[model samples]
Target: MIVGIDLGTTNSAVAIWRDGAASLIPNSLGDVLTPSAVSMTEDGTILVGVAARDRQSTHPALTATAFKRLMGAQKPVMLGRTRFSAEELSALVLRSLKADAEAYLGEPVESAVITVPAYFNDRQRKATRRAGELAGLRVERLLNEPTAAALAHGIHQREDKEPFLVFDLGGGTFDVSIVEIFDGIIEVRASAGDNRLGGEDFNDVMVELVRGQLKGVDALPLSNSELREIMRAAAERTRRGLTEADTAPFSLVWKGREIRRDVRADAFAEAAAGLIARLREPVLRSMRDSGIRTEQLSEVILVGGATRMPIVRRAVTRMFGRFPNASIDPDHAVAMGAAVQAGLKARDSALEEIRLTDVCPFTLGVDTVEFDRLGRMHSGVFCPIIERNTVIPASRVHVFSTVRDNQPVVEFGVYQGEARQVDANVKLGQLSIPVPPRPAGTVRIDCRFSYDVSGLLEVDLTIPETGASKQLVICDDADAPDDAAIAARREVLAALKVHPREDAANAATLARAERCYEAFLGERRDHIGQMIIGFEGVLQKQDPKQIKEARDEIERQLDALEGERFL
Candidate 1:
């Protein structure tokens, strides 16, 4: 059976279509959400999800998070002795989610539909499909996150037929889209987003606040990694608390100096004020490009866990001059909608009547040379044939002529972006074809582009002069590893033993104590240090009964010293 997976930046989840409805499958921990964190322990063990996240504060150098922002980039993330691309880190998360889905369904799942930010470029989307393949699952479809959210919310709505908007602000990415539904048909009008903008930015703001204060008195006495993890843990706690309470205090100790500050809603809003401003531009652009008026939108729906923050809600309301609908859980909407899409792909009886359509989030064009009447030529100009937000499963063709007399070949550099210059756009791929030498502007070539709903792009070039043609399926081949390389990576991952599933609770407890021990000093630090050693010894015994007994005591001691985790 096919399943739906939401491989997100900060978290991941899995779902399946069952009993005529979409059902979210819980992970081994009996939770619907799993942190999208991966880490290598000091003993050369790889941990994913909860264990990895818990260890992040203690092992910052060997842990990687938020790599989703680097998707399609050339940079490599250095974690310990290895360098990994963004897709490789993402594949680990996907593999973990696949394991969870299989365990819950009691079956071996081989295919899935994964969701991505609506505004992801061609390279990012293709990389996501590659990540799924590396995880041993065939990606059936690449559904846009905002479009998936709409499907989840509008799936059972038989009475409401008005148009709405989906504002998705997750942990590491943001996407805004306008949606219209009529007669069991859902259509996405337009989309816009910032790949690097999200709730994590707010967390960074809190971290900066601490850094600024530390610089005021003296230079940091601790290592950069130590300071970073401490600030991340504290800031995240304060950020999550501020969602429900008006004030959350941030406190930490360094070199006998106590840093204490209360982060109130007003102060946080002031600190995160810039992020709020950035959110407006995308929404306004999406509406303007979609030719939609503010009054035409019957409702504005907020999707993504980041939307739960009051500041985000207030920002949305201020922009639209109306309150947004929060009936659907922002955290689970995307994954749930993915399940619906999975059902649609399978042609399930319940979803047989629902017809959904999406648009291309970017314009596809070729690098062309434009010659002026004065005999001046301008190169690197982007000639768009298919505009952004055009209905998918669509094709467009543009005819071009050679720039110079007897030009031997035509080099086509295909790009996907809004920039007017090819240099500013992302080049998905390129193809060069040899053309019979002809006089300038005499030979014509048909540049046809076809875009499908799955976010894959195909470019076809045909020369009417000689009936010769060339085509390029836009995909990033350089970033994709061969089957042998993929197998090698998998073997390495499989070798780095993940903490046993049954011992997750004990493993988490030990990690938390280690983090606490590193952050404290004086007698409190010594007490936690001994507690950690004791737990480690117990874990080495491999006796589940003994480990549980020791874990309860260790957790109690750490809780007493650390107070509440999110305080």
Candidate 2:
């Protein structure tokens, strides 16, 4: 059976359409949510999800989290002794989700529909698909996250038709999609987002607060990685705490002393003014692109876990002069809607009459020559073909001729963005098709771009006079790995042993205690240290009952010191 997965930046989840409704698939621990974190032990054993996340502060060097932001950068992230590409790291998360789905369904699952931020460029989308491939799943579709959330929202509404907006602020990405539904048909009018803006960026604002407010913080012995992860965890907790209370303590230990500050909601809002401002552009752009005014929207729907924050909700309220809808669970909407999409792909009888259409989030075009004010030919000009927000599956064609007489070849540098210059846009790929030598205007070539439902692009070029033709698939050279490389990475991942599931709770508890030990001071620090020692001693005893008892007690003690329930 095909499943739908939200391969999120901070957390991931999977769901399937069963009994005519979408249901979340639980993992081994009976939790539907999985933290998107990966860690490598000293013995080369891998740990994912909560176990790895708990290790972030304790074993900062060995753990990697929030790697989704680097998806299309083709950069390597070091996890212990190994260097993993963002694709490889994402594949591990996907693999874990796949296992959970299989376990829940009691059957082997192979195909999936994965959701991505609509603002992701061609390279990022392709990288996501590659990640799915590496995890042994045939990616049926790469659904836009906001669009998916829209589907989930539309499904539960009683109205036959309505227009709405989806505001998605995920862990590492933000997207806004304008949607309209009419008589079982869902159409996305426009999409806009910043792949770099999200909840994690807010965490950065909190980190900056610590650096600026805490004395001698700049002189601390923390490495860039350690400081970031450590402060991010603390800031995240404080930020969440502020959601329910006006003030929350942001504290950490340095040497033998405790440093603390009360973070006020008003202060955080003031410091994050720039980020709140950044959120305005996308909503305005989506509204403008869709030709819909704020008042025209029947409801503004909030999606993604980040939207639960009061600050974000207030921003949306101020923008629209109305309270946004939060009827759907922000965290589960995308994955659930993706499951609905998986059902649509399968032509499920229950959804046979429903139709969904989505827009291309960015403009796709090619480089061309344009005459400047002085009549001088300027190359590297961007000539748009498929405009952003054009509904897909879509195809558009444009004709062009050589700029120079007797030009031997016609080259097209495919790009995606809103820039007027090709260099300012993202280059998807380049294509060269041989043309018959002739005067500048004598040879005419037609370039046709076809964008499919799954968000892949195909370019077809044909010269009318000579019938010469060429085809180019949109993919970045550096971002697209060859089959051999994929196989090699798969082998590398398969060879590593995974930390035993039975011991995950104990490990997580110990890791959390270590993190607390680092964050506490004086007596509390000493107490956590002794607790860690006691847990290790229990593990060495090799008695399950004794270890479980010790682990539970230590977790309770850390919870009290951490005030985790308050957060």
TM-score of each: 0.92, 0.94
Candidate 2, 385-413: lDDT as tens digits: 99999999999999998888899999999
lDDT to native, each model: 0.84, 0.86
- lDDT of each residue in 5-38, candidate 1, tens digit only: 8888888889998889998998766778888888
Worst 10 residues of 2 by lDDT: 214-223
Pairs that collide in candidate 2 are: none
Error of 2 at 316 (Å): 0.8
Cα lDDT for residue 398, candidate 1 = 96
